[model samples]
Target: MPSSVPPFSELLANTRESAVHFEMRDDYGTNPRLEAWQRGERINWDDRESWWHPFHQTIADAVARGVAVRRARIVSEPVSEYIRWEHYATHANVMAGEDVRWLPRSQATGFLVPANDFWLFDGKLIRVHHFAGDGRHVSDELSTDPGDLKLCVSAFEEVWQRAIPHSEYTI
Candidate 1:
């Protein structure tokens, strides 16, 4: 939410038609929330009030507005612990109305994917996520280049097609 890039909710607010998130990473280290989940804390999943957070609110709002909110992650098989945590955490994302999918990296051989993670909104612009080699956050950037937009949309669609829905993917 820093720099010139807009906050994600605002971007989602402005979107129409679609908001596709394409992620390509194996390990993202750890966070306090993740550690808590790993330490045996669990969401009731049925209690909407207990886990419906602002991020989920944004996605739900978009879906209510008819914007197709989708998320696709390309990950390595025999996934990292972080990814294992993410797989569980994704239940919230799914409940919020995102059509989430997962694709193993080994099966992504013939497709093209961007070098970084990005959220392409309405296929007009993208907010790219940059990370350190060890998988720490660095910064975010916004891009509106036609070529970049095309690549992001194409890459996302290809991976999304090959990905398994969250309910179907196994660890």
Candidate 2:
């Protein structure tokens, strides 16, 4: 984590062409919504005013500016409850103009996947998310190294190609 690294919003705002995210975890235990869902507090997907958040607005703004925003998740088969909740809530992301996809871990056999989740902006910079054993976000590592950038772009594209679109994927 660099002391001068820009915030994620700044990275997204500066991105000109694309912002692709790769999520490789099955359970993001730190998500508050996951806990809420577990306790039977469901999100009213029909009410955009209630469900939409700042991140969704950011994606919408990026898309409005002609940036192609895509998010691909690689999860284990027989997905966890958290994944199912994500799958359900992903409609909000789509509504916000993001292309979301899901790929089973078994399907990613030979691909060179990165160890951590990352957002590759315009195929140039990467913000890799570091997480603890219990799936809590620890910190983010930013890199613009050519090699790292190449790896993130290649890995995301490969995963995107093999992943099923959100509308078609089922947990």
Candidate 3:
């Protein structure tokens, strides 16, 4: 159970190590590990081409460590492009036994805010809405309430149900 007043980092530390979840159109973070999937060694942050950052690595690492990961997305051309070339399939094989769910983008409907990002983990929820031209400062929505978190989880599950199993997913 997370407290309502503490900053997100505190709540994150108290939760189980593998409980983090995110709803993003592209990846997040500035670590070197992200370079592996992106086309070039350097990422173009502001563009869609750079979307393959830490998100893929994080999920891949989580799966390798035996944490369950579920994903729902609009299945943009980029995701399929990576899948087609077997970029992720290779790492995906290491955690072959665990389940990885993929839901179509259309299924994400209302949840996909063109300029906002969503994250849900344990009982915490964080929503980041981008403002400005280069995505400088962003607005956030944070809550530890079960009801709010459930909405995000439910959205994840709805797409999960309609998604193909990892084994069958293809580019």
Candidate 4:
């Protein structure tokens, strides 16, 4: 852990080559969007403007600057409500020029992977996110430790290799 862990936007802005995110959770507690989706609310897919938020904007900007942004998720199925919502909304990520992929938990058997979610920046530094069992965020760390970096980078690449592209994944 470093003394100063920059915010996600700052990390993204500073990344020169690639940014990869590894998400292994099926739920993230609940947000307004998750709650809405849980109540059967759905995005009006035709109206793309309504869903464009700052995160997607930042990702788009990073892509424009030549940073390759990719996200990989290892989820349990038949998916949780949060994952279902994530799948439904992933088109926004695609539109933002991010490559999104999903790997079922069963598909990743026997692989050594991180316990926390993380964003690996330029393959050197990582920002790891900690969450509680019910899926509420707890804390995060920015690390450059050699062992941590090796595991994060390798695990992510393995997951990315086995993951199904967002466009092709079903449920």
Better lDDT candidate (1, 3): 1
**Over the stretch 84-150, how does candidate 4's per-residue lDDT look in tens digits?**
8889989889999999999999999978999899999999999999999999988888889999999
- lDDT for model 1: 0.92
- Candidate 2 regions exceeding 4 Å error are 1-3
* Local distance difference test, candidate 2: 0.89
| Of 2 and 4, the candidate ranking higher by lDDT | 4
| lDDT, candidate 1, 1-171, per-residue tens | 458888999999999899999888887767887889888998898888988889999999999999999999999989988898999999999989999999999999987788999999999989999999988989899999999998999999999999999999989
Runs of candidate 1 with Cα error greater than 4 angstroms are: none
Could you tell me the lDDT of residue 131 within candidate 2? 86
C-alpha root-mean-square deviation, candidate 3: 8.4
Q: What is the TM-score of each candidate against the true structure?
A: 0.96, 0.94, 0.48, 0.94
User: Residue-wise lDDT of candidate 2 within 15-113, one digit each (tens)?
Assistant: 999999999998776567777877899887778898899988989999999999999999998998778888988988999999999999999999798
Candidates 1 and 4 compared: the better one by TM-score is 1
Candidate number of the best TM-score: 1
Any runs in candidate 4 off by more than 4 Å, and if so which? 1-4
List model 3 lDDT by residue over 1-171, tens digit each. Answer: 443344444433444534434334433333334346455553344463334434455555555565554433435544643343332533443243235555556555655233344545543544433444443434455665776667666665666667766567665
Decreasing lDDT order of the candidates: 4, 1, 2, 3
